[model samples]
Target: MRGLGRVLDRREEIEEIIESEHKRVLPKLAEYREKLKGKTAYITAGAAHGHAIIALLKELGIEVQGAAIFHHDPVYDNGDINSDVLSSTVKNYGDVKHYNVCNKQAYELVNILNRLKPDILIARHGGMVIWGAKLGIPTFLMEDEQFGFGYQGILNYAEKVLETFDNIEFTLNLAKHSTMPYTDLILGSSWESSLAKEIKADLLILSVPITYRLVLTCGYVGYNGGLRVAEDIYDRVLDTYR
Candidate 1:
């Protein structure tokens, strides 16, 4: 597990990456309706990921009630639920939800969660774990690169010169997040396990970004790639906390 110090050391760089981040979370789009239909979630913090998730949920049939955005400005697309942007440094998405909590503190965040009590809470930031735990909501932790990759990279180079890139795609990878079950993260990556012994949730949704990355990069092959990733995540989470 990477420590707080390690994570902090790369904080600025990570923030940049996460701010520019693009993660592929397609869950076998065919079953998307089945997986997300009738389900609801609260996407807190980080607009890009939140927007991505909002799209994902909508595709899957789940309703994205709203987001507790932590970027530059609150983007308002829906008339009802508003988004929260913490500071100017954090970037917001174009789909723009509403805005409200501008200068408020913990009360605003928890107050919103207390009101929503969403079925699932998806947070992409690697730093803030206490807030998620405090919300006492079933959380999904998204890790950037904790999972293993390289099952298909040919790394072909002529005279160390970069040649055309051809990545081998996996139809599915059942072992994507095998170690998650042993950790404390909801999406149980090492991110949430700093003082893991101090806090353990009844359930965790630990996700692996590596396998799914390949899936999306592979396009049509992503359908199978995503489902297999989910299966792997689900099985590991079940084994650890279920």
Candidate 2:
């Protein structure tokens, strides 16, 4: 019982740190609100920040027409984001369509974008960004520089690896002994190469330990809050184009 209690306490502490870092990036969203007015935009974001950013954009007078929300999970299910709040939030924006971008086919997204005909696209993950670019739409990406316990969505890979191996000790043993690179081992060769293509991320939000440091490297600007900053950057692009 004592050991369980200790583990729970540590988990709470980590959650607190993540939550705090998430809030810290929110202020930057305010900087570009006004610049977003009048543009019709589509956004892809996770539950936590995605819903909030949508509300903020509405307040700023931007016409957000479609969104693919990666819902904040209620339970730990490797990469499966719950769309509970996200669906409702999109409805609040009056006819704004919401899509579940979690593990869905790319063509579905392309079809949605074609129907929405947004002036710009804002996304929180690599896949959406690539889809947006393929359609010749100006794309903006906003995502934490890393995710899920201070890694590049590593938990997702860990979960998939666990599924593949089907045993805890064996999974760990394979990870320890496998000659394959960790990224390749976890994400597989197909995803590895595709992830490489997604590397030219547009707007990266610094997360955890160095949450406040904003760096704009790789031709992609870095900001504090995840998708909120992406929305801001997308708004500015809208301002320039329209």
User: Top model by lDDT, which number?
Assistant: 2
Taking all chains together, the TM-score of candidate 1 against the true structure is 0.36
Stretches > 4 Å off in candidate 2 = 1-35, 71-95, 99-103, 145-242
Cα shift from native, residue 168, model 2 (Å)? 48
Q: 1-242, model 1: which lDDT tens digit per residue?
A: 12443667876666555444323222233443554457666666555445555554444455666676565334554432344322321243234243332312555656666577666656656544334455455455554322211211111111011111121111012223122222333554444444343544433323443332233333223778678656756665576554
- Model 2 lDDT tens row, 86-117: 55555675555554546345766777876777
**TM-score per model over all chains:** 0.36, 0.38
Estimate the overall C-alpha local distance difference test score of candidate 1.
0.44
Model 2 quality (TM-score): 0.38
Highest-TM-score candidate: 2
Question: Residue 209, candidate 1: how far off, in angstroms?
Answer: 57
